[model samples]
Target chain A: MKKYLYIIKTTFNDSIQYISSLFIRFIGFAITMSILLSLWTFIYQDNTTISGYTLKEMFWYLLLTETITFGSKSPVATNEVKNCIKSGNIAYQINKPYHYIIYSITKYFADTLIRFIAFTIISTILGLIYVGPINNISIISFISCIPVFLLAVLITGMIKILISLTSFWVEDSQPFQMIYSKIILIFGIFFPIEMFPKIIGNILRYTPIYSVSYGPAKLMLSYNFSFFLNILITQIITIIIISIIINIVYRRGVRKLNVNGG
Target chain B: MLTEVKNNLKIMFLSLKYNLIRVMENRVSFLTSVSMMIFNNASFIIQWLTIFTLVEYIGSYTLNDIMLFWAISSGSYGLANILFNGANKIPEYIENGKLDAYLVMPKNVLCHVITSSTEPSAWGDLIYGYIALIIFNFSIKNIFLYSLLIIIGALIYTSFVIICNSFTFYFIRFSETSEILKDIFINGSIYPDVIFNRAIKIIFFTLIPCALASWVPVHLIIEFNIYHFILLILATNILIIIAFFLFYQGLKRYTSSNLMEARS
Candidate 1:
């Protein structure tokens, strides 16, 4: 735990040096959100509500979704795992005090937290400027959303690690990364599952991506105690399942590495 | 000048051929990348679908018009990336002094640099673009016009990227800024032109020139106007000329990194 803390602290410090680049990324996100806002505003130029969401609500919803999608990016773990496998650096890490998986997760968490905070602040300011306050979000709901958002970040990190570990066999994990991100972008980040066709929405709810992206955003948009509980339970289950899969895959990959004299 | 043009075209074709063969060596990776790009692009259709579901048309653009918008945008993006991908990497090349190889080559340095690489996933975009066009208008005339428009759009897109990237020579560590500019141009191109106000519209036409890449081309395709077509061609050529001038002007200031590196 202490070692993990140290890793987090160091990663956080490292991220600060790239603050200008992060600001540039924030500008990119702002431009994207502004585009969405214009598109939605134009769509609602005629009528008031569409499928129970006001134009303001829709804008706010998009803001939250964009926040989750951009904020929870966990490239560090993916790259780290890929490099370790490619360069046989995993052999060196295997002898370290901390578990390799734990170290990777700590680094991912620290980097993601720095990005998430920066993005959230930027998005909020942009939202306030563009659409004003949402007016429906309660303080309680926002507070309750914190833990679930952290869990969502963790789930995303774990999934990235799993994808990265595939580099042990595959020549490149970039395609898998692209596909997974697209799924999240389409089904989870772009719209609430409820807005999807009923059957498709229900099916997506069963997938882990739902918990990773939509769960926290949905809670913040309009919180219900039962809804919160359900998503929380789903997130926990996903984390456990993915963790087990990672452990199995990492162990097998290490064994294969040994056989190959890596 | 004609001889130089013919020579550059020949070299560009050869570069593209070798790049294709290189990427195809990893068959699964290549196929996966292309398919994923297509799938990713397809997802945007759903967002528009949801919008149209709520309203029949937004700002004189029906669902069909929106589809045409995407077709042109994706098709132009594909054309630019497939043939001239190095525009995106100009900053890195300048920063690391990787342009030494191109400078030593006999061909036009800018043309050689841009054609030196190709993005396989852009083929997916090209395929998706044609699919959208077929779904919308499959006539022989439309096909011919689509080809011409894609060329015009690609030239503008490539020149815009080059112009953005040439800033690297003027300022140290401006790569991120270049990326942000490219992102804005791309994100702006994907949407309908009606969404932008007059000020932004002006910026899109002049500073970023994103309108030349997709929106103006889509308009020309939908309703053929010889005047607009002529204007578009003139603007694209002027932009390309400006890009070439800026690149060469910046080249004079470039100091080689003196680091030894090999190209595979």
Candidate 2:
């Protein structure tokens, strides 16, 4: 635990040096959100709400969803595992003091926490500038959503590790990761599940996309106790399932591992 | 001038052939990458399709119109990426002094630089583009227009990318910013032209030039106007010429550190 804390601190310090990249990404996200705002504005010109979201809620919802996404874009942390496994760079860590996945997760969380904070602040400010404050949202509901949001980010990270672990079997697992992210992006980040057909929406709720991107944002905008309970439980279950899968995959992968290095 | 043009094209083709061969050496990775990219691109269609289901038209675009827009954008992107993936890599090349090799050669610097690399997964994009074209709308004239405008689109797309990447010379470590600009260009291409108001639309047309690769081409597909076609061609050519000018000017500032590197 101490070493993991050290890893987090080191990774956090390392991430701060590249602060300009955050600025650039914020600019990109802000531009994309502005475009979405325009589309939503055009959308709401005739209608009061979209997918049960008012225009104001739509902006803030999109903002929160995208912020979670921004926080989860730790591809370097994810890709490093795949590359190290494939390149046999993991051989050096065979006898490391700390557990590999735990160390990696700590690093990923530390790195992305900066991005999450940056994305949330900038996007919230932009959301205010674009759509004004969410008059209908309660402070309690908003605060309550934070744990679920962080868990969502963690679930996303674990799932990525699960995908990355496939390098033990496949020639390259990066493509699967790409496709998975796109699935999450389209189903989770871009729209509320309410936008989808009823069957698809229900099916998506059973998947990790809802937990990773949508559930928290939805609960924030319009807090419902039952709804929050369901999403939170779904998220907790997802984290458990993915963690078990990662442990299983990692164990099986290590059994097949062959490394030749001094 | 004609002979010079012919010689440049010859070398460009040779470089492209070799680049393809090199990437294909790992056939499984190559195949997987291409197939994965196709699926990756195809997955993007669901968003717009879902939007269309709720709203009959997004701006002036219909359901079919949106599909056609995607076809144009994807095909254009695929073409630019496959043949001139190096446009995106210009910064890395310049940063690493890999541009030094191209300079010593007698070929057109920008031409050779861009064609010296290829992205095999872009073949997926190219294939997906044609697949989308066939699925969305198919006719002899439509095919002809697609082929022509796809080239126009690819040219416009590559030109702006090169122009974005050429900023490596003016600003040290400008690679990330160039990458962000390139992302904006590619990502913005899917949206309809009507979405942007006058101010931003002007920037999209002039600075980003994303519309040339997508909305304009899709619009022409819907209703081919000779005047619009001519202006599109004109704008694309001007962009390419500007790309050439900027590249050469930046080339003047390039200084190689004599680092050891090899390319097969």
Candidate 3:
């Protein structure tokens, strides 16, 4: 447990370095938020609400989506796997002491932290201007929900790595990575899976992405202990399944690899 | 001169063929781009349908007028994208030191970059635009006017994108400029010109000049505004001149850094 904590601390430091180095990226993100928030505010000015979401609720939802999105390792995880395979770095990884998956998980955490800070500052300012303070949720819920959100992030990361490992067989994994991440963003970040078609909704109900964004967003809004437990159980089960699949694919990819470094 | 024109046409066709072949060779990137287009067009149709359902009409233009506006906007988007996708990413090329490849190429550097990226997503918009045009059943006069408007509109936007992209040579961070340009062209141009009164309309026409991109052209086609018809020709020439000057200025500032260093 202490080792894991140390690993996390080190990773967090690395993420800070990354954010400082690529400072322009944060500025770009801030501008993107302003554009989106202003556009939503404009639309909301005409129609007070859409569905059940008030202008305030809509703003909060946007903030929530943008804030949590910084934590999405779904793309980076895939990119790491694809680059590793393409450059034959997977062989070097075999000799390393740390697990390859741990490296991806930690990097994602660091990336998310920087994104979260930028988002918090930007959203806080925009939210104040547009709709005022976010909903008054309980402190208990806020504190308790942290783990669930982290669990959600982990699930997203695992799923991305799983999709990325496909590149070990195929020459290029970008198409699969793009389609996978889009599915997660559109379904997970933008719209709740419940709003999707009945067939897709049912199929995705069992997926890890459900635990990542939808389940957490719902929990943040309305907390039912039973529903929370169900989400937690779902994430655990998905993680186990994905881990098994990764191990199988990793071995197969190792055999198929030409071991030629670019 | 005629033979030169024919040769240029042949080269353009060959370039298009080469572009398709290059994209096809990298199947993943092509598929991702096409999918992005599908997603974009789908969302656009849904959003427009929602807005149209709510509003009756603005100005003399009715729902059909708005649909024609939609079609023209969509067509301009596709045409400009096909023509100027490379110019769009000039900042990145300049910043990341990737512009060297184009600068060294014997043919026109701007042409190489502009033709380098063919967004499959714009193709979806192109199809949708034609559909919208046919559905609106524009009058003969309106059709002729709208066709001319579309050409001018594409030129205005193409020049704007080129000019914005050239700014990357001076400013290291230009993604913001492109983002702002996108907002102006994509979302800003959609509303009827009548939404703004005369003064604001004039500003949109002559200064920031978004109306030349869509609103003025579409409005003139339907309402037969003589001033705008004349303004379109003037706007086209001004935009072309601006683009040429900006590109020339940016090219002059460009230090011929080695390709390897540029990649870094």
Candidate 4:
């Protein structure tokens, strides 16, 4: 645990070295948000609540979802895992005294923590600039956003890691993460699941996209104990299932490499 | 002059053919990459589909109009990348001294630098564009128009990217800024033109040139207008000329990194 804590500190420091990249990412974020806001404003030219969300709620909802997409460090995990497996560095890491899973997840958490903070602050400022404030929210709603956001980040990292671990079997696994990200973006990030057609929205409710993006944004906008518990349960179960799959994949990959470099 | 143009075209095609062969060496990777890109592009349509369900028209842009936007945007972007994918690597090359290899070549520096590589994922986008066009606005005339406009749009997009990337030659600070500019330009095209007011439209037309790349082309295809067509041609030529000017001027300022590099 102490070693993991040290890893977190070091990773955090490394992430700060490249602050310009974060600013560049924020510009992209701001552009997308502006586009979305413009479209939403045009859509809601008269109507206030289309799908149980007012324009303010919609804007804040999008802010949180976009945060999940950009701030979670999913793509970094995908690339790191892919490169590690491709370059045969996983062999050395697995044989080391440290646990690779802990090491990698800790690194992701630390890196994402920095980005999450940066994005949250920037998104909050943008949100305020766009919409006055998110409505229909109590202090509990704000409090509930915390756990779900952390879980969303974790869910995203785990899913990306799972997709990238398939590098052992597939000739290419990089695109699968893109597919997963697009799923989350379309279903949960750009708009709430409620905004989707009924059948599709109902179906998406059971997917990781719901847990990873919609859950946090929804909880942030409106806090219901049952909804919070439901998302929490889903996130926990998802983590467990994905962790088991990742272990199986790593074991199989190790056997294939025969504990040797690729 | 015509002979020089023809020779360069021939060389570019030969390079593309070889690059295609190289990418296909790993058949599985090629297939997966192409399929993934198609799926990735398709997912955005789902988002717009959800929007269309809620509203009949977003600024006179119906489902078909949005499809046209996607078709042109994807098709044009793919065409540009397929031919000049190395434009995406200008910053990296400039940073790492890899531009040295291209500088010593006998070819035109900008052309050689751009055509030296191909983007495998762009094939999926090109196919997806055709699929969208056939499904949405299928006509012999429209197909011809779409093809012509896609080429025009590709030229505009390529020039825009080149202009953004050329700044890297002047200052390293532009490396990330260029990337962000490219992202904004590309992302701007995925949405409907109607959502943007006149001010935003002006910005897209002048600064990013996404309107020229997507909205204007799609509008021309939907309804042929000779004036807009002429304006489009004039603007594309102007943009291309500007891009060439900036790149050559910046090239004069470029200092070699002196690090040995080779293209495998």
lDDT, candidates in the order shown: 0.86, 0.85, 0.67, 0.85
lDDT of 3 by residue, B1-264 (tens): 787667655655666667667667877666666665555544544444444544444446666777777777777877777655676777777777787887775555666666566656676566666667776754667666666677777778777788877888887677676666556556557666655556756766665577778887676766776876786788689888888788878888887556575321
> How does the DockQ of candidate 1 come out?
0.67
Model 4: CAPRI class: high
RMSD of 1: 2.1
lDDT tens digits, residue span A1-262, model 1: 8889999999999988877778778878888888888888877787697777777877877887777668877678677789888888888898899999989999999988988888889988998999888767788888899899888888888898999999888878877888788778778876777778789888998998678877877777778999999999999999889999999999998888852462
Question: Runs in model 3 with CA error above 4 Å?
Answer: A1-11, A20-50, A73-75, A192-209, A223-234, A260-262, B1-21, B24-36, B43-77, B92-154, B173-233, B258-264
lDDT of 4 at A248: 87
DockQ scores of the candidates: 0.67, 0.68, 0.12, 0.81
lDDT of the structure predicted as candidate 2: 0.85
lDDT of 2 by residue, A1-262 (tens): 8888988899889989987778877878888888887777776777897777888887888888888888788975568889979998777776788788887788888888887777878987998888888777788887878889888888888888889889988878888889888898899887899999999999998888888888888888778889989989999888888888888898999889998866
Better model by DockQ: candidate 3 vs candidate 4: 4
Docking class of 2: medium
TM-score of chain A of each: 0.94, 0.94, 0.81, 0.93
User: Over the stretch B1-264, how does candidate 4's per-residue lDDT look in tens digits?
Assistant: 898888778877777878888888988777777888889888877788788878888887788888999999999999988888877777777777788888897667788778878888898899899989999889999999999999998899899888988888888768778877888888788777878889999999999899998989888987899999999999999999999999899888777888875686
TM-score of chain B of each: 0.97, 0.96, 0.81, 0.96
Reference-based TM-score of each model = 0.94, 0.96, 0.75, 0.95
Highest-TM-score candidate: 2
Q: Which candidate is the best by lDDT?
A: 1
Q: Give stretches of model 2 more than 4 Å off.
A: none
